[model samples]
Target: MDRERVVEWLEGGSVSIPKVLLKHYADIGLNEIEFLTLLHIHESIGSGNPFPTPIEISNRMSIDGTACSEVLRSLMKRGFLAIEQQDVSMMICEKYSLRPLWQKLASLMFETVHEEEEQERERSETDLYTMFEKEFGRPLSPFECETLSMWIDQDDHEPVIIKAALREAVMSGKLNFRYIDRILFEWKKNGVKTIEQARNQSRKFRQHQQPKQGVSSNEGTRKTTIPFFNWLEQ
Candidate 1:
């Protein structure tokens, strides 16, 4: 690892993180020490060898073996490093750099305080794609994956919400990705994604329409029925 090259690399890029990555970084908020530890590993292995042992990194960074090992695992998860240890040397690669797509994800770990958020993102990104490919019997296009990422980032929308919206749109015979965004945008604005909120909204809407329905049951009943599960459904 060239100390000079490591320094140059760090200083060179503006670190224009992808939105998903930025969200992960902001949520995880890696401490300076952890970030520095990752940098050390990058320098120690730069274009030279695969993954270096914790002891080697510990010696160079002047840290304890245990501490270095712990941090190394953390870095591996957070996408700063990749680790593959076999009967031989461990292969490590930097994922957060301008690396290939596979390595890029390897270097990332969401900085979320809530474990649920971290798990949720992982589930949507990994499992959703896996399921999609399995069901369709074809891999999603890169652009399609990007669209999924966009949907995830937009509004902090979870897969559950997105999936529910998709089901609704499909059932209503209005399913379209573009429209889905608009629907989600509106749902988020109204704070009505959950079933309880939807139920509450339905009750209120029905209450508002009660008088009109009483006046003209024929016409008014149709309008009143529209909100039977308005909030919950859409």
Candidate 2:
């Protein structure tokens, strides 16, 4: 809400963090400053640029440039922030949220990160639902619809990923509950239910198979090429 609330949340020490933000802190531990640095970047730019320069962010936050640089480096190492510099200004994107974790540590320090989305988002979600149903040729049950909606609403998954998962389930002769579950599981594991990931996985599997086959064939050829008696004599 306000600047004070935002800073408080970042400082509040919490063990359990939000799933979104957990990604950042999961590897290396993050402190109040590191957390605030991420929030500062988010306030400056909401997922606009994947990476921003430490100097720009420091200037905006009015903190020491050296301190900002150190924090940025820490964030990068911890996987909380990514860095990309162009000819012009450096861009930054908040990969995770520290608010949820802040709530756990101290509600007083908890601050909401995302403000409510614009009306256009709501309308777009409705349209996307309609399109999805039309494409599926069946009105999904309430539970199924909700699942799909959440997947769509949460920018985590792209529509293409869901479609790809569905397609893979169908083609694998597993167009059943088990198949769908497997697809979702894979999606969760790799955060990629997209067709591209699926195709890449498929390619990798084929490559793996080819190598095994090649190895087997080579062994067979080698066995034939040399006689057992010759080997014993040597």
Candidate 3:
């Protein structure tokens, strides 16, 4: 196929089947025909036809109508499918419900979801540690680790804000964690919780202490000296 044609084919709209269904269909006691029937029903529902008749399913799957009906019956008997009637313009139309299948899938996925969340949290903690080590230029001590943990777990300081405070401290030529902690403490006391707030506070402090131009004693030369961290003394 030409590259453009291949790209168009790949980008075309398609049905989505849950990975759980594909991986655990056999474990859930479904045979090949039964699984395909479920997939067809799911696709029909996505296409705005909630319940496809046996003939429609059979035509799509190239199976005989009788065989398709038998597979559907087996699926319904096993509590994986349901057929209900709904009034559409005063005509009863059959609607298919896959609630049973979804409920079973959710139960199977609960532990997997919990494990993924734990993995994500561990990865975030590792990234935070790496960031600190790179900034501090050495491995963290046990006490420093405990302090980081306390900031995260006990004080509820977000890692992003802690990193921002560390950056602020570095810019002020004080790279110690203690100095960063004091910066965080001052920010919290002043209700500065986000990086933007910290930045605004810093800008206000700088503007408040911006030195006025003065004439030198001898030659009337203009002199200006910028003050740093003068607000911290307050």
TM-score comparison, 1 vs 2, better candidate? 1
lDDT order, best first, reads: 3, 1, 2
Pairs that clash in candidate 2 = 51-91, 52-91, 52-92, 161-194
Give the higher-lDDT candidate: 1 or 2.
Answer: 1
Clash totals, every prediction:
10, 4, 0
Best by TM-score: 3
Residue-by-residue lDDT tens digits, candidate 2, 186-225: 6567656557777776455445442222235655653222
| Model 3: residue 171 alpha-carbon error in angstroms | 1.9
Model 1 per-residue lDDT tens digits across residues 84-119: 434434653432232332254444443223666777
**Decreasing TM-score order of the candidates:** 3, 1, 2
lDDT of each: 0.59, 0.56, 0.84
- Clash pairs, candidate 1, are 27-111, 28-111, 51-92, 78-108, 78-109, 79-107, 79-108, 80-107, 198-231, 198-232
For model 2, give the 10-residue run with minimal summed lDDT.
225-234
Better of 1 and 3 by lDDT: 3
Best by lDDT: 3
**Cα lDDT of model 3 by residue, 72-176, tens digit:** 888888889988888999998889999888877777688678989889877877888898899989999999999999888998887778888878877878788
Judged by whole-model lDDT over C-alpha atoms, candidate 1 comes out at 0.59
Quality of model 2 by C-alpha lDDT: 0.56
